[model samples]
Target chain A: MVHQYKLNGYHIVLDTCSGSVHAVDEVAYDIIGLYEEKTEEEITAQILEKYRGREDVTREEIRLCLADVAKLKQQGKLFTPDTYAPLANEFKERSGNVVKALCLHVAHTCNLNCAYCFASQGKYHGERALMSFETGKRALDFLIEHSGSRTNLEVDFFGGEPLMNWEVVKQLVLYARSVEKEHRKNFRFTLTTNGMLIDDDVIDFANREMSNVVLSLDGRKEVHDRLRVDYAGNGSFDRIVPKFQKLVAARGGKNYYMRGTFTHQNPDFTRDIDEMLRLGFTELSMEPVVCAPADPAALTQEDLTVVLKEYELLAQKMLDAKREGKEFTFYHYMIDLTKGPCIYKRISGCGSGTEYMAVTPWGDLYPCHQFVGEEKYKLGDIWNGISNHGAQEEFCACNAYTRKECEDCWAKLYCSGGCAANAYHAAGSVSGIYAAGCELFKKRMECAVMLQVADALPRQE
Target chain B: MKRIQTLETKNLCESAKKGGCGECQTSCQSACKTSCGIANQKCEKKDER
Candidate 1:
């Protein structure tokens, strides 16, 4: 299917199934829009009348444009048929459910209490605890054992505050590095922290060892301070921002994300993004607050309306910045149009549950961090591997085409059927779809497409 | 910024049918896909100044 839209002074057309993108002038754009339903003669007449005053839009030019659109259709470039439904289930089969990555919850406790934290302040509704070194070691071994023939194994040090158990995180990284060579494996380690405990040692070790570091900050001081607070009910923004800035500065050219969550309290998230930009943060992501509908921080329908406009504004701002040699990258807008995810990844989604799983501090396995502490989703422990094969099969069966709502949606392929954890939380099933997240995703996809169109296509005016 | 129209696809998965899926490690990011400010993989490509 061909989806057409006008954005940022350009007419962009995208073929959803085939992943073909085209930019055309006004007459050509109009003709391509009605090429399917209307007769050629009718389209030509409509275009002629629409552009009647423009001498540049003659019937001869319309004919050529019509021929070009038809040529694209014949070549399976535009209006491409959806032939991926049957292959969707085949993704899990191709890899044989070999494990590839693990998100190790080193600590189930947080230094700061953020109101909208979906992790429930890192406890996940459980008691506070730090993963023992023994548990972490076993988790790594579990990943290696289950990962058949895959050399590039990934482990992310995540938690309430990974740095809270600093010694264990350090030891785990050291252990992984030491064993990787003997096993003929390459372990890429990443760490995500709130920047509360960042210092010389943290910075030095992260730079030297971790493949990537993710720092959490919610834009400006007021917005950040509103929810992210300390035990004393004091805002932790002041405490964390300086630390994060110092860490990023020391990080130099290394990869990092200055991540933030925009809640209903701040649906004008573009301002927060601007705040991040002003703080010299270029690599950023300001996600909408995803929580139970009853939660005060949860994004409401009205908030969603504002948030959509914010995405559009953010895209336009990025384009302007790119032109001015001040471009900042947004996580959602980082669309590698040329060589995106492989077909297997595109159809199968995030590879969670089967190819990837989350390990709690105690070594209990879940589909992902979002499913941690939930008995229903517990697949097994690191010692015995995945005992609950049913959960694995369920995640394996879940993909872009699993839900009927996603069948006709143009953004289906991009999002990979949305997050399974989000689906389960919202719709009470892993296979179900999160309607709000879907709407936000569609808007982001549109903006992402617009950015690529502006950057990759020739503009008419 | 001179934007040019382009088709950005190598369709590598197309070759997977011929048994080419697992061998390619291609720039796939983090294992966990959930975006709970925790597991989401950071994809930051900083442009060299």
Candidate 2:
């Protein structure tokens, strides 16, 4: 089960038993290459020959190594904020600490109304009329002020289709540039758009000034139009895909990420993922939509089981392509890879309530993206800076990994702190949200891996 | 030498399957599969830790 290969003269040894991937020596593979001839059969023969009848490597060792290779080769690691801090630091040095603030819904207005959209369903309740230039200024001020320790700052424009106020976005970027000069901070930018309005101008601006451009494209035409569309009940997939194509072509397929959300309604998820891969995006992220407050949508046991099934199948396809040296990366899957192992020992988990913060266009701030305005999870306000109340203290105090109850939990470390939003929403308190969610996500992961391995195993049929 | 040094020094290479779900009957492996197996294993260990 353990595999060893040399790439660019590096000896990459995948030791499954040790559950470790060791580049034994950059030269070990070269030595193997020089000493042993290359060929699939020869390589396999050589490996068996070298290890076979070796009394030192015990059967237990062999078993451990096979498992190690299988586990490491298949799964990466879950990211925690602490682990991502160094990257944040590096990005700060290269770009800045406050690189990007993704304002998901800048304007409450939307042309198409999906059944689940907050703005469409909630009628933009208490939400600002639009991401006014003033509101954008306040948010920029907070970032620039806080970004003193950073070299460059990136501001990402987002929305319930930000194109609604594309003019405001354009103006804000210009305004932000001036603020950067006034405050003497380096500024970079990007935007997440629904390709409906990716005209030549937006494409031109995105390609020239933006470091990354992310577009939301739900898979296949029918599924996409059904969930993401104008209020008139028409499909936007055909309209958006053509624009998305031109945008990708304009950039020559570099410096961009495609994000999609899947719902239970779409059964052919593999097809959806395939179409996206075919679209030439090296980076992609697919999150199952946080369904409505319905019987099946509420992370029900059955719902989770089905989602877990689909996730494993998709992940296996991704893994196979990756093994064959594909350049594409699924963002969530890459999270584990980018995190590496040992992420559990350190405070390396999600960036919630720490490095990253989300600011609504109206100047309200939430610690992370997942729980934008769930009042209880609100960490601070942009107008007054981060809330000075015990919110920070409350957040720090609820470190579930340190708790005894969670100590024995199988997913404590990697689960880090589960979604603060979910904690409040599910348990009505953040008290053990991390532990609870950790356990939940663990079950999902286990199911995913189990299904995939079973499918790969020799079948009875 | 550097590769060996790095590998030897890193505990991430430790293959100790301490407190894993494979030992637990109700774990996800009982019912289904996951996208990231190693991650799930690590998470199981982390939770156990």
Candidate 3:
């Protein structure tokens, strides 16, 4: 049986075979009653009226309009006039040339042995290393030269462990301050760390220099211990939480984030939300673990349930936090609020080829954290820089998935194609890492958002 | 002929004789054989209504 699914303005056919379905879109649908049951003559009259006094409305113009309308109608897809027109205007308004975010991999060496390490793929090995002072200068120079005068640039420090290379980080932060001073450019600094390194020195530096810091904590001790362990198989949770405590004490509910990755292994992980709040972290970001056969942290089906359950719980926890007079915010909510209408145009999440770019120690520029090691999807080498202009062009052209197939997908906007590393290693592609994660993250966020939004509303007695 | 879920699930341990249907001999088969065992489970739960 053939079932037609209308997405955006296009029609796709899903062919069902033996209870399985495959999707295809080829035929154009007719558009007479697309907006209702208007006759062809009535539609023609309306088009003529709208295009009145325009000498360019020739027979060809009318024919094209009819064809497009017909195609839309047959596909059972129709966009209201008000909705479609502004979206078109928005497409024209977006700046096609700006890089909104920049990911700087300041170090190649990691402090822990994550079982699902993309760095260990094929023959890629880990080594203790840091981005040199010279490379740091070059990166800053490149950003200064390339960024437009009016653009806001965010510089994010990623790792092995970003704090492992604190020396270079200090230099970079100082440089970014100078850049902001000289160019009067809007500059924001953020760091993603493994939490064990969030001591006083790091907290002081982040508070003084960087705008925000993200710490990786996979729920509780056991789940984190199993996946993110040191060489001797010791768990990092107990060691890392204290450092987070210090940061909380230092910042004291100002604005610091605790980021957690709950792979399928952490069952009923939602319980950690209260614990995280109790620990005094005001902001939180949670990501579900994507499993590959070779990933060290593969969990049972029950684990995945726990991860989702925890996300749902976090939503309720945020509501409870508000009720208790606790002031806190999640980044996802900020995005939905601040990002204006063309949110669909923003890359679903983050990556090099989209809003951000990551540089490895070898001076190779891949999209972002996810595709750290796979060489095939390497966008550019740091020494020479991104060479393929067209690949970047195609990367920009992809719209955030929002058709019937992708709408209601939780990660729709957040997944940002999944990790570039995951795409490159698992599927040997870099095109949709953000999309894969977008679907998952969207599912996570929607439940959280609904719970919070409901909690925020005035109750009807 | 008997149904074999996905080839990857039944490839390792499930033995089928030339003229006979066979039972899966390993735990992995139970998970990998169908439209992905995890996916199947989700679908089953979804369909309960």
Candidate 4:
């Protein structure tokens, strides 16, 4: 299918099935739009009517445009057959049972009460608690038993603050390592923390054992402090920055990412990113805050233009950095076009409900980390296998191909129908699209395209 | 128009679903490697290219 849009005065046509993007002239754009609906004679007549008075616009010119469309059709760039349906069926039949990754909510409560905390201050809107050692052990055992032939498995020690339940985490890692030889499975451990309790011992242990660490420090001191504050309303920036720096230094800035969140307050978000760079972070991802629209700091419709412009500015800065050989990777900017998501992913999304699952502190299983606290999404406990196969099947069924809006979207493949949690939060359905998030994704895609093209161009001396 | 006019028009997913697992294996592989220390070597090699 062909999806066309006008961006920055250029006519962009996207072939959805084949993932081919083209910048065509007005005549060619019109021809592409009319190709399926109208016969060649009708299309030619319509083109003539569009450029009625212009002597330069002739029947021959319209035919040439038609020829171009036909060429695209012949090259399988237009009207390409659906390859995802068969693959989706095959995947469901052969690959749905193997659970490869699990996000272990080691701590149910967090110390900081960030303004837009999705987990409602890390308690997941539930009571404050930490996962016991026995519960964690059972969850690991569940993963190992159900993992099928998958030799590699993932476990993330997540929480209000995983460091709050540091002992259990340490013991679990040691336990997982001990059982790996017997089960013929290798466990890779990751720790996500707020960095408040990251002392020398915590840092030393993480550096030695954790395969990756995600440090949450929104941005600059002021921005971070405004939203992410302690229980006493004190800013975490002062306490966390030093710890984060030490952690990064110890890890040699590898296998870790400094994750930040941008809100309506930070319209010129590039400045926050610049601050991160100045603070000596190389791997960075500054995501837009996702929360209820009622929140004062949440990004609204009014903020879309400024937010998109900020992304453009950041993209330009990234290109400039690349030129200077001081390049740092931005998570959103790193879209590998050639080896991007497959047709299956573009349809069914990241396989959250099937391939990946999240386990709460009490061993309650859910589709993913985002759905951990909500009781309705609970698949089962670790003691029992997945009891709610229906819910998992429902999530697995949600793909771009099944969503009416996404069927015609050019950005569908890149977006993969968007995050399921964001969709549920926005419109109460997994197939729905959040408007602000969708807009941000499109802007990012446009910026990514520009960056990719910029990189391919021959550098002038 | 002037900014993007010089962009070499290209398909975003040229080799997508050609021979490998039809997913952006980077995310899953990285999630495993960073969080678990278990690397999907097959995906790691593909991502490096």
Candidate 5:
């Protein structure tokens, strides 16, 4: 249950079950590697040979390393038995249809054409359309009807730009509120927009009715402008920044996130975050771009080292901000290991097909928003409730438990296997691992752990 | 058996409330649980120590 990796010139070992992290020396690292498979005598022998020529090597040293291994075993940091199987079995046995959240593609056409747009400028590789009020209403009804005993239901108005279909979006919100009282459900609405179309009306409506809004802004004007261009091939930064500031000011800058994406072009992505902080944004999430590997802007193997370094720098900056009493939560740096792994997360992955499904503008249902444009992943439509139950079942069954690559992985517990869409995009299979994303996730986790440790260390007087 | 019982009895919402599950409020609890894979157990016995 212990996973080891080298970072910042130190070997960091994470015990998945107990959530214990240790920065161990090379001998300790080697011993941990052999503890599960080799006998102590064998481990000692191997260690002895590994350091035989070194002046620092000694039989006492090897014995001490073995003792340390035994201590870890006694403390339950190492040799923690696999408990995933029984839990996986129970999860599979108890898996049921409980649709709790729905992502409604309110508009399938966006004004701006981001270079890395997964939906290919928001058309999703299909005809540009807006969700008719009729379809949106049916989708809302479908969620309430299928939600079972879940009192808090969620619906995300997603799109090329949900703002494009402002009237339908508003009508749907009002309608959802009207139905909520009778259904004994609380509808939590969220709007994910490109911020180009934000106006006083949109801001006022969102503040009053929307649970939260996720506004996309890449970062500095130069960085954002390079990729996020409007119909006239002009940068959106100048247009969106003022609107974003206005919207944030209207909402008192709460219950909103200024979400950005980092790509190969910006390996030192911390600078972008610094710019966001300077712009007075409190809630921020800068995610790595998910695009084809062949895309020029895509983060490739060459960018990983710099990406890793930037994450470390960002972690340090976060620590400094906390010390200065100006703490802001970075989405990726947030990891709580105190509680054991979430059984639900391990078994289900990202609820793409099971508990949450995406409804296209045309009333077509897919497992998640990422699959809206892809025909192969279509589950059903609003008229027919989940015709492709098999697809849902497949998503339900997918987890680190089912993935062979994740079986022996220590990071598996933290990651719970990665995003299903990302996996599909990278490996052409839902169950496959996206190598780049996987590495980035691990690197982020490492940085998070380091940050946690740094934060715990007392400030020098 | 102990672990399974611990997991069953633990409150997923409580841990989520403590900011352990970052996007809990914004996400479907069932789906988030499935995705997190963190078995809902009594806050780790170690944390109590």
Candidate 6:
């Protein structure tokens, strides 16, 4: 199927099946739009009527444009067939359950009390707990044991605030390092924290041992403080921002993301991103908050419109900034058109249950951190491995094709059927599509494509 | 009116899909390597033109 849209002064057409992107002029765009549905004679007549007075848009030129569309289709770049549908299930199955990543919830508790905390203030609506070093060690061992021929395995030390259990976090890294070479594995660890406990030691060790670090900051002080407040109801923005700056500064150009969440309160989330840029934080991601619609922080219908425009503006701003020699990386806007993820990766979506799982502080496994509290999703523990084979199979099958809503969606390949965790929360099933999220995601994809086009086709002065 | 210009004919269907698991590349939808270290594009493969 083909999808067409006009954004940022450019007409874009996406061949959904073949992943080809074309930027055509208004005339060619109109002709291509009609090529699949109308006969050549009819399309020419329509274009002639539409561009009646324009000499450039003659019937012959219209037919020429139509021929170009036909050429693209013949080359398998336009109106391409869904050749990957039959291969989706078997393609993913070939990966064969070789787990390569594990999210170790080192602390099921947080030092701060962010009102919009999806994990219910890091307790995940459960008792506050910290994972023991032994449990973490076993979790690393579980990864190595199941990683098959994969040499590089990843472990993310996540939590309400992982620094809440600082000693164990350090110990687990030491343990993983101690055994990585022995097991013929290379462990890349990441720490996701609120920046509440960053210090010289934390920064030094993070730069040394951790391959990457994710610092949680919701942009500007007022915006971040609105929901991410401390238990005493005071803003923790001041306390954390400086520390985050220091840690990232010491990171020595290593991998780090100044991750934030955008909600109804901040639909003009680009302002928050600008604040991050002002603070010298380059790699960034401001994800939309996925919560109940009834919640005050939820993005309302009006906010969706604002958010969509913001995505377009964000892309343009990034391109302009690059020209001015101040380009920053926005996570979703980073698209590698040349060597993007293979079709199987795009089809199967995020491997939440099949190849990746989240471990709780008590060593119990869930498909991801979002499903941590739900007993039904519990996929056994590190010691016993995945006992809930049913959930595993369901997630393994839950790819872009599994969701009916994704069938005709143009952005399905980029998002890989959307996040299963967000889908479950929004629609009450992993296979269900989060409609609002889809809208925002499509806009982001459009903006990403436009940015790529702008970079390639610099405008003439 | 630039005509119908193909900005990208990378053809992810035929080329990209054939490679087994590229969990670390920016192309993967997971946002990062293996377990989603969260938007980790530090290792983004430069375009091999």
Who wins the DockQ comparison? Answer: 6
lDDT of each: 0.78, 0.50, 0.50, 0.73, 0.73, 0.80
Given candidate 5, what's the lDDT at residue A71? 76
Clashing pairs in 1: A456-B4, A457-B3, A457-B4, A457-B5, A458-B3, A458-B4
Q: In model 1, what is the error at residue A204, expressed in angstroms?
A: 0.6
Of 1 and 5, the candidate ahead on DockQ is: 1
Candidates 4 and 6, the one with greater TM-score: 6
> Candidate 2 chain A, which ten residues in sequence have the lowest lDDT sum?
A77-86
lDDT of 2 by residue, A1-461 (tens): 13354332334443322233445432333323433245434444555556677554444543443444334334431110122323222322332223133343466556656655534432344553567878887787777776544445556565556777787788878887777776766665667777777899998877876666777787777777877877677878888887877887889655676777666666446667788877665566565555344723234455556655666566667656756787565544432322234432222223334434666667677655445556766777777766744664444444434345444444443444455545554565654453333544654444333333333333222
TM-score of model 5 vs. true structure: 0.83
Arrange candidates by DockQ, descending. Answer: 6, 1, 4, 5, 2, 3
Query: Where in model 1 is the C-alpha error above 4 Å?
Result: A458-461, B1-4, B12-49
Q: Pick the candidate with the highest lDDT.
A: 6
What lDDT score is found at residue A259 in candidate 2?
Answer: 70
Better DockQ candidate (3, 5): 5
TM score of chain A per candidate: 0.97, 0.68, 0.71, 0.87, 0.88, 0.97
Model 4 C-alpha lDDT versus the unseen true structure: 0.73
lDDT (10s digit) by residue, model 5, range A1-461: 77777655456677665456666667778878898899878987898888789765577777776777677668656566665555654553454676778889999999998999888899989999999999999999998888776677889888889999999999999999999999998888888889988999999999999877888988888999999998889999988988988898889645777888888888788888988888888777788887888998888787888887888788778878998998986766665545443444444465668777889998998988778777878898888888887777778776667678877777776666777787788778888878777777777788777665455433422
The number of clashing residue pairs in model 3 is 32
Binned by DockQ into CAPRI classes (incorrect, acceptable, medium, high), candidate 3 is incorrect
For model 6, chain A alone compared with the true chain A gives a TM-score of 0.97
Off by over 4 Å in 3: A1-96, A118-128, A294-296, A299-302, A327-351, A401-428, A431-439, B1-49
- Top-down TM-score ranking: 6, 1, 4, 5, 3, 2
Better of 3 and 5 by TM-score: 5
Q: Could you tell which candidate, 2 or 4, scores higher by DockQ?
A: 4
Model 6: per-residue Cα lDDT at residue A220: 87
Model 6 lDDT tens row, A155-273: 88888899889899899898888898888888888888888889999999999988878888889889999898888998989999889989988889998888899889999999999
B1-49: candidate 2 lDDT, tens digit per residue: 2223113212332322221112111111100111112243223233432
Model 5 residue A408 lDDT?
A: 74
For model 5, how big is the CA root-mean-square deviation? 6.0
